[model samples]
Target: MAEVIKSLNLLESLKESIEKNNISDIKDAVEDMLISRINIALVGERGGEKAAFINSLRGLGVGNEGAALCPSSAAPDELAVFPNPKHPDFRLWDLPAIPSNTPFDPENYLERYKIIRYNSIIMTFTQNSSSNMVAVWREARSLQKDVYFALLASDKDTEKTLEAKKKASLEVLKAEGVSQPKVLLVCPTALEKLEFLMLLEVMLGDLPEIRAHALLLALPTFSSTLVAKKKEAFKALGWAAASLSAGVSAIPVPLVASMVDASIAVRILTKAQISLCLDDESVERLARQRGMDPTKLKGLRTCLLSVEISKSEVKRRLSVAEKDTSTATTKLVELAMPRHARSVSRSFTVMLQAINSAIDDMSADADKIIAVATGVSQ
Candidate 1:
């Protein structure tokens, strides 16, 4: 268990180092850690429906009345967290289904929920005729990122109803410019019979790739494989912690305390980066200029910059360069284009040369700091 925690810390350090553009030594270190940890999360709407579907996928027996677990009656606005029954390292957060009658207000509610935390949203629909699922689809579309959908069609003979619902859902998604929605259809009997394992496997297979894509959009330089491996390591460590707790007598008290402190530190640092990444204007501007989808960019510029300037004095110096050159280039390009692409290109080349000269000048100042620090230590 201590080893597991250490692996997680190493993986995180690798991620931070890469973000800081200091990846010369960490590649092998991360690869070595990946062999021991693999973790995944299952997220969907609450009410026992999502749980029942997950249980079916795990081959758990459904109760006798053909009625699966009852969907929670709690207000659909709260976040729900549940542990994966089959995989100790995995967690499933069952989100409250978006209410059909209530209109969504994007401004006030966007950042208040856990919707942004998960790798993907697993939207479940009851049969093809259910309009409730369509409402959910609409809400997911408003957010403008790829979402995965699963259809839980009724076993009853509502074939036409099911068909109509599916058609309407697809049309709405298409009109909103969503090209693909990962769709899965399963029945109550299938849930009871534990036959949904195949579907679960398919979904699971695509998860790592999807998550990799998300991380890449946020931090282009950081490899997707690295992010996935880190996630896997975190899960493994969590599972190890749970196991250690189960046989409490076998574990020493001080070791447990140290492990808990490390886990808390990891979680805190991860959360701190969220705001920095999402709210940076420079990142959003660069993302737009590059023809990269903003949603795809996931506010990575802040993450990149944060690592480069982790020290307070270094950060203050970088902020000056960031403010001056970053925004002006876009305006200059806009003003220069079509008068002559070649002329504009030449101007940009000159600008980059000047920037490089300025950076070299700044490096001399950094040398002075290093000299002073070295002398003080001596």
Candidate 2:
């Protein structure tokens, strides 16, 4: 049987870190969780639809501002980087295409591309997988990297041809000593369909635990699975912030804790709004991409935090949150930190309650917006 791993209790660690008044560690933790670098490398031939795949993953259209330049050509020694407009820290890199005639050195290629820095690598192909790329894939596996094979299909491909391509790719990988290889057949223009979400889920499973939450929040698509994962991620974020606030205000002064919690609430809610694409800019961007009126998209918002998230607004909400000692919030606090359930202040519980409620509302707004954009009933 596999050994069970014990998860780290971050709240406990934060409490200890705060006992020494060492807010730096918890502060750094929060910042890292909020804006960590997540780099993905895409290795494909020029005009192999790498740019389209990257743009789709980043939720950008070809003509949109900050969209990746399609049909990319790059020098053999360098990697071309494309940053997500909403989250600059997340990037997609287009690695230079392998030379067909040259004797490829997988080790040298991996080193030249600086593959170690990337969180994941995706090898995309329109045709069969190149022996050279497969060699690099093998080398990447030896280094314990999360590498995937993706077959880029287009609107022209029929079901039979798509399955044929996937089978051919798998055969190539298996022949090259890959056991039970899984190939993702992806249509770049239609990421909401087919194996794209499956690919995302697989990658999430393979990624480091710390990165799973970030990846979930960073994804631009609005699906039921993603919505659920995003809610859990935001809940964890809220818990972290609440725990940190309680630590900072160790004396448990309701006024001081309330102020700290309010500030943290603003940060969390603002991030939630953008992550769910409910912010004005994101909504307008989504509308423009769909060739719809921005006002129509904006009108669907029913959440308080869906609009602009201001400090004054957040404070007002917290004032109201502090008034009602909701049983749901109390139970959540108890479940989150059982040992300190009795001692955790009212302000901390209230902050969690308010943050949780706001996230749910924003999630609902996101669902409504997606339904309207896709002309599907929610």
- Top TM-score prediction, candidate number: 2
Model 2 lDDT per residue over 1-378, tens place = 001012224666655555555656867666766777788898887563667788878877778876767455456456888888787778888887766566778999899889898899998888778677789988998899999988888767888998998888888888888888889988887676678888888998898856766767776855665766677777767766766665566664557766777777888888788788888877887788778999999999987679889888788777777787687667655444536433655656777667777788888888888888867788
TM-score of candidate 2 on Cα atoms, chains taken together = 0.90
Please provide, for model 1 over 218-259, each residue's C-alpha lDDT reduced to its tens digit, 9 standing for 90 to 100. Answer: 221112232333334334333222222222212345555334
Backbone clashes in each candidate structure, one number apiece?
Answer: 6, 0
TM-score of 1: 0.37
Model 1 scores a C-alpha lDDT of: 0.38
The whole-model lDDT of each prediction reads: 0.38, 0.75
Q: Which prediction has the highest lDDT against the true structure?
A: 2
Give residue 200's error in model 2 in angstroms: 0.8
